[model samples]
Target: MALLETLVVVFAVAVVAALAVVVKTRLFPLREGEEPREDVAEYISMMVSVFYALVLGLCLVSVWDNRATADDRVQTEASALHQTYLLADALPAAQRQPVRDAARAYAAHVVEVEWPRMAEREPLGTEGWALLDRLRTAGELTGRATLSQQIAAQEVLAQLGYVDDARRGRETAAGESLSVVLWTGLIIGGVLTVAFMFLFGLERNTTHVILVMGLSGFIAFTVLLIYQLDAPFGATLGVAPDPFTRYFPL
Candidate 1:
């Protein structure tokens, strides 16, 4: 969803919840002797809030670490590709241009074609692997080449190995997400945390409304933030193709 739409939903839920608390207090005012036991309620509420906070922390950490790993993969892949490109200079005259061209083509495909697919959470298929294979084929040299050329070819292969590993890491990161069980816990926890506020019988209806609204709004924002970060490539704070562009500007 767009930022504006998300904000609207968050604010709408908060306002509706706050209004419900208002109506609830009006309809069922707590009498002096009828007020629920504050001590027990406070204890339970504190425990629930603490557990919910733990869940939120776990979710935030999971997504943040995934994003950081995705970023690292991008940097590694781009650096390896750049190294391969530079190594092409030491190759034989007949082989140098092909290797460089293949490197450029692979970079272009990643930045222009594959990036959008990743952002859309679409299947990458085998196109990227095929491109990488082509790069490997282009770098191949005959036994007629000298020792230096052979050594350059070996270095190029090593760099391509890094690129392959990093690409795999990147793809895995793109598909990674919290499991359904964790998601269920997160949602249930947030709801219970917010609902606990309703059990309290504060003297001022205004104060009660304010507390519920603030807690609900903050929880809503946190959940949404986690959702956005769950998609490492697609989210607003997602990994970018800047590493590729920096190495092979198009």
Candidate 2:
């Protein structure tokens, strides 16, 4: 729904901009005596276009990489939790169920509680960390144990460490976004790129209108795409929590 709303708004703005350009041309039709300096105008517009393309490409790549990294972190966290759950069998009979329960609880919390908060860009507070600590406590053996139990405990701890690291990465990525400076550049550059179309002298007014409409629509769509990708876990192009569900089956 949000994505559809965004698309409607962007396209509406583009249409309005195109109409404005057409009205300006109709009101002040290029006078017979005046001629557009195509040489200078084309050169400057070309330079502006090149620079804007570079910036657009950079923004796209940055968001794409961040989203991919966020996805990887989720997978790693889920995989580690699954490993820890499996290792519970090797622990002492008394501690086995507790450890498995802890692992399940942690996974469930992440999928049900923490995920919605991340999606909404809300603060996760300390509950997730507290749950992680509880999982660690459950897996640790207080008394002396056999070699196999000791090894299993250590492996569980190691898996938990991976889960911790991945969780941190996931949290960081959830809040990651493009900086203000880049956003300003993107907006200003797109405007300039489209505005340049009006300066060119076209033999037919229809041609001029068509060109402006196409340019405006395309630029608006690109900006919208970047905006959607900027929110790694909340926006239209965000990463899903399928990894967690795959391993821990909510």
Candidate 3:
């Protein structure tokens, strides 16, 4: 779903949950002597809050790191392609233009075609691989090439290897996400945390309602943020193709 739609759903759920708590409390009021055991409820709530906080922290760090790694892989791939293009200058006149053209085509395809597919978590077809093969073939030095040209060819091959590795990494990252079990924990934990607030509420109903609303809203916001960050190449809050555009420039 779109980010705004997700947010609306989350907020609606939070509001409904808060309203349910309010209605339940009004229907069954606490007993007069219940103060004696209120501390226990508070302690349990505190523990749950701490545990949930830890889980949220860990999830946030993991998703943020994954996003950063995805961006780095893009930059690495672009740099490798750029290096391969520049190294063509050291190749023989017959071999130089073809390699450069192949490198350009690969970069163009990645930026123009593959990037959009990645946003949708779709596969880039054999065309990109075919372009890489073309670049590799063009960089191959034959019997007539000089020693320097042969060395350049080897260097170009090495850079191509880097590009291939980084491209694979990018593709893997585009499809990466937090597991379903973890998502279950996150959602259930948030609900339980808010529900616990209703167990031992404030003296004033208005104050209690406000507290529940604020806490639930914050939890929903955090969950939404994590969701957005989970898929590094998702359409929302995803890494852009700036690296390719910067290096290749069309």
Candidate 4:
């Protein structure tokens, strides 16, 4: 509930900030009663347009990198899990099934249970990572066995280690704080740029007004979309866990 409220607040602030640009420009004239500075205003507008373009480019690149990072983390984790599964054959007969079961169970839990909570930005329940640890330990205990089994056991342990590290990476990546800051800059930049639209005693040109408002609206909307999707695991507008789900039982 608290997180939802925070998200709402973030969203409200962004929307208001974005719309403020349109309203400040179209409805209220900031340069009322001032003499025209046509040449200076035109130059400033051109510069601001460039600024807006750069900001937009930065936002797109930032979000794209975040998505790619999350996807790569998923692939790394999945690869480890699969490798662990195959390496279970190295375990003694008594321990082989246990390790395999744990691996599959962890995958299932991630898909069916953890994924939903993560999507909602909720912390995962206990027993999820615990189960993974158990699988790792089970693999480690295969020590001093047949050489082939020992090698296999080592591979499984290595893969399990990979899974642990990848999971940690996912946690860090999913936070996506850069998006938050980018949003702040984007929205503030948009508002300030548009506010400048009405500055300094300029004669109202209908065409210029239309162009300014249209550009403002588009920039604002694109930034908002990027903000919503910045968190790859977030429910608002993020990557779905269905890909992870496929590895699970249910």
Candidate 5:
């Protein structure tokens, strides 16, 4: 629902931009004197460009931090999960395989099932979490063994904490209100910048090259910025699901 609302807002902005362009070009034709004196248009464009750069830099910083934090969280979770797995070996023979099997199954379900859905921003189902609970309960450490199990259990619990926090971070990164706004600004600024170009009476031979360069660069930078943030779990640039793979896998 929130995503849908964001889309609607963006669509509305695009519509407004299109209408503004039509009206500006058709009715308020650009003329040397009709615009402000002392190259006011140029000054405004320069200021807006500078501001846009600042905004772009800020967005990069934010996303980079978000990705870095997510990575750290996953690493922490992996460490905790590893401790729990090793502890399984110290359990009584009858309980060791059961504990390890439960952990492995939980890890596999997370990697195979939960991840792809998160990529699409879907809520993780309750079943995987239920499995985690089962893994915790399967310990069956009573009295004397309980102390050893606590050491491992505590670590696994900590890892689970990290995993949950990291998921929230990943989700937060995607739902960044400012990112959508920054993208809106970049796009609108580019259009206004380009449209202002058309208003200039440039020579026929020289205009195309400059126009192509401006549009190409704008499109490339703006697009990839958004794309890089879209997935928090898929590639090297994305959040590492390796926590599960390294410690929990069969």
Candidate 6:
């Protein structure tokens, strides 16, 4: 619903800008000798358009890569936890169940609790860290044990380490967002790019209006696209919990 509202707002702004250009042109007609300056205006507009395009492209790519990385981290974390669960089977019969249960509980918490919180861009809290610590503790085999059990414990700890790293990465990604400066640049640059279209006078008034409307609409659409991708886990197009479900079904 928020995304839909953003789209509506951007579209409305674009339409209003286009209308303003039309009204301005009607109110103050271009002078008879304005043709000589058009070449210079066109060159300046072209440069501004090009620079803005480059900035937009950079922003789009950065957000897209961040989203992809967030998805990868989720998948990696789930996979490592699943491996830890399986490694538990190699431990002593008494120790195996606790490790497996801890792993399962951690995965469940992530899918059930942390995911929703991430969508709201809120911290996952200490509960998740507590669960991870439980898993680590359960996987430890410091007491007198068989050689095979010792080796299994080592592997389990390693896998837990992977899970921890991935989880940290996921948390960081969830909290990540585009900087305010970048957003300011995108918004101001978009307005300038659209406003630049008004400088050149076209042969037909309809042509001018259509040109402005199209440029404004495209600029608005690109800005909205970046906004959606800026927060990897908070947007509708965000990374999902499919990885957890796939490996550790409820």
| lDDT scores in order | 0.88, 0.88, 0.87, 0.76, 0.66, 0.87
Ten-residue region with minimum lDDT total, candidate 6: 195-204
Assess the local accuracy of residue 56 in candidate 5 as a C-alpha lDDT between 0 and 100. Answer: 66
Candidate 1 versus the native: TM-score? Answer: 0.82
Q: Candidate 1 on 1-250: residue-level lDDT in tens? A: 3545655776799799889979988998889689655797799889989999999999999999998999999999999999999999999998889989999999999988878888887878888899999999888886599999999999999999999999999989988987666687788789888887776765567877788788899999998999888888874988999999998999
* Model 5, TM vs. native: 0.71
Overlapping backbone residue pairs in candidate 6 total 0
Estimate, for each residue in 105-201, the C-alpha lDDT of model 5 and write its tens digit.
8778767887776666577778776876777776656456556666765565565566556545645553443456666666666666666555654
lDDT of 2 by residue, 1-250 (tens): 6546655776799899889979988998888989855796789899999999999999999888999999999999999999999999999998899988888888889988988898888888888899899999999999989999999999999999999999999999988888766787799899889878766654467877788888889889989989888888874788888887887887
- Using all chains and alpha carbons, the TM-scores for the candidates as numbered come to 0.82, 0.82, 0.82, 0.74, 0.71, 0.81
RMSD of 5: 5.7
State the displacement of the C-alpha of residue 214, model 1, in Å, after optimal TM-score superposition: 2.2
Model 6 regions lying over 4 Å from their true place = 1-36, 203-210
Question: Which is better, 1 or 5, measured by TM-score?
Answer: 1
After best superposition, candidate 4 residue 172: deviation in angstroms?
A: 0.5
Q: Give the clashing pairs for model 1.
A: none
List all candidate RMSDs to the true structure.
8.5, 8.4, 7.5, 8.0, 5.7, 7.9
lDDT of 1: 0.88
Put down candidate 3 lDDT per residue, 115-187, tens digits, no spaces: 8898887887889999999999999986588888888889999999999999889988988887665676688
Candidate 6 per-residue lDDT over residues 112-196, each given as its tens digit: 9999999889989999999999999998985788998999999988988888899999998999888666676688788888777
Query: Which one wins by lDDT: 4 or 6?
Result: 6
**lDDT for each residue of candidate 4 in 1-250, tens digit (9 for 90 to 100):** 6556666887899899889878977886668687745886678777876887798888888877887787788888877887898777767887888888888888887777877776666777677789888888777763357877877877887888899998887776666555455566677678868777667443579888887879778877887777666767777667666555555545
